[model samples]
Target: MAPILQVDVDALRQLAIDMAHAADTIHEFDLTQPATGAAESLESSSVAAISQNVSWSLREAYRHLAALVDQMATGTESAARIFEAAERSFTGALRRIH
Candidate 1:
């Protein structure tokens, strides 16, 4: 006989919700300051460019995580349904063994 599987759908959903909320809390700092030093030296320009790139990547990562979390939360209902179906089938098989 297959092992019975137990799951806490509500808890999973809540975790996903929490993750999304946490992701939302991530705020990007202002990095729009112009690089002005030694008459716009190469080092200053490179630093500014790299900082901008890093900022953009960070924001994108946060948005991605939030989106994934939201999706997981939304899919919890479907996951619960599948689990319910499996449990029902298992119960039926057990009953036939008597």
Candidate 2:
């Protein structure tokens, strides 16, 4: 198994807070049909439309989540790079000290 790279914990926490805040901004409403004389037929049509709309909405939501995840992943990668750089620098500095 490949060893997991260490990332800066603070960066991870910041990214999670950012993503959660962004996600919170999104508002979703129920797509229920209003009662009317033609409610029966409207219900059928609305059902089909609801299915399509929900699917589209879900797809869009998934895309947004994926983008957010990628952003977090990029931040994590940066943290990993910083950790590795700090490790190397400290190693070199220790050698110089000795």
Candidate 3:
């Protein structure tokens, strides 16, 4: 029996959510005048971090699914089938990343 254990997904989602909230808060601040330097820096960095987190999470999700699919493929199928399934998912994830 092959089992998948994922315990950090919530941490990843919460991190992204927090970054998004920070970005939104900074974005709404009045920009016509000099704003808090720390806030501006936070906004940019937080947005970039959120995007990176999203990209990484999405990639990892696909990789995890591919591995599971590969495991499923091998129950009564050849490695070629598993390879094809993994390739298909990897291709999809690559497309999504782009």
Candidate 4:
């Protein structure tokens, strides 16, 4: 006997939407100005340079994370559409057999 597989495509679609929203929120956040201000307030030039480097690193990391999340949302949305299409096809086949 084969096991039955159930998928909630609507939930997948909603998850994709939520992920896209989260990615947008993360991308929109600005960390550069505050970091630059803090760096400027520092007394030592070397320390300020390090602080700027750290800020740049953090900003890049956030950008990368946002891009990854956006990709995942796109993939999830594609999966939902594929699943829905498959389900519709299966239902149609069953109806034709009856």
Candidate 5:
């Protein structure tokens, strides 16, 4: 049987914050310098273009990842609230029964 895992909502939120910082870091790269090559040819431009495209794509991917992480954190917090409410309700019910 698989062990049940308990997650801390506050920790998840912190992780989301960390992911957002990482995404910001990735988006801060400067890709203005052209690529180095053996000769001053079209290869440099092509390489530079490709590098810029890759960097842009990576930044966008990280941005999306951070957004997703934020959503997870929010969901976890909501779930925690719901669980707390349920526990309170259950406790009240037990008190009434006693």
Candidate 6:
């Protein structure tokens, strides 16, 4: 006996949409300006350098995370499409046999 595969394609598609939106939000976020401003107020070159490095690191991290999320969104949408196609194919095959 084969195991039944049940999928909610609509929900999966919505989740993909949501994930895409979240990735966009994360990618658009700016962290450098505030960090620079704070560092400038401290008036120490070492502090400014450290702050810039931290800011750059954080921004890079967020960009990487956003890219990953975008990839996941693409994968999820692809999965939903595959599932929908499979369901349609199965239904058509069943109808032809009837």
- lDDT for each candidate structure: 0.61, 0.59, 0.49, 0.88, 0.57, 0.90
Q: Each candidate: how many clashes?
A: 0, 0, 0, 0, 0, 0
Candidate 1 residue 95 C-alpha distance from true site, Å: 11
Alpha carbon deviation, residue 69, candidate 5 (Å): 0.6
Candidate 5 lDDT:
0.57
Using lDDT as the measure, the top candidate is 6
lDDT of 4 by residue, 1-98 (tens): 12123788889999999999999998987999988898889947788888889899999999999999999999999999988787777877777999
Q: Find the number of clashing residue pairs for candidate 4.
A: 0
**Which rank order by TM-score, best down to worst?**
6, 4, 5, 2, 1, 3
Query: Which segments of candidate 3 are over 4 A away from where they belong?
Result: 1-45, 78-98
In candidate 5, stretches whose alpha carbon ends up further than 4 angstroms from where it belongs are 1-44
Report the Cα lDDT for residue 53, model 6: 86
For model 6, how does the per-residue alpha-carbon lDDT over 22-79 read when each residue is reduced to its tens digit?
A: 9999999999789989789876668877888899999999999999999999999999
Cα lDDT tens digits, model 1, 1-98, are 45477777566656756755654564333323432332245464667566667656766776676677666655765676677688879889888998
Model 3 agreement with the true structure over 1-98: per-residue lDDT tens digits: 12123234445445545544554444344432333344356575766455555555655665565555444434324434454566667777777999
Off by over 4 Å in 2: 1-44
Measured against the true structure, the TM-scores of the candidates, in listed sequence, are: 0.48, 0.51, 0.33, 0.88, 0.60, 0.88
Kindly list the per-residue Cα lDDT of model 5 for residues 1-98, writing each as its tens digit: 12123446456556656655665565555433432231234454666566667656666776677667556656666666665566667777777999
The better-scoring model by lDDT among 4 and 6 is 6
Q: How far off is model 6, as Cα RMSD?
A: 3.1
Better of 4 and 5 by lDDT: 4
In model 1, the runs with Cα more than 4 Å from the true position are 1-5, 26-44, 81-98
Candidates ranked, most accurate by lDDT first: 6, 4, 1, 2, 5, 3
CA displacement after TM-score superposition, residue 75 of candidate 5 (Å)? 0.8
- How accurate locally is residue 35 in candidate 5, as Cα lDDT from 0 to 100? 27
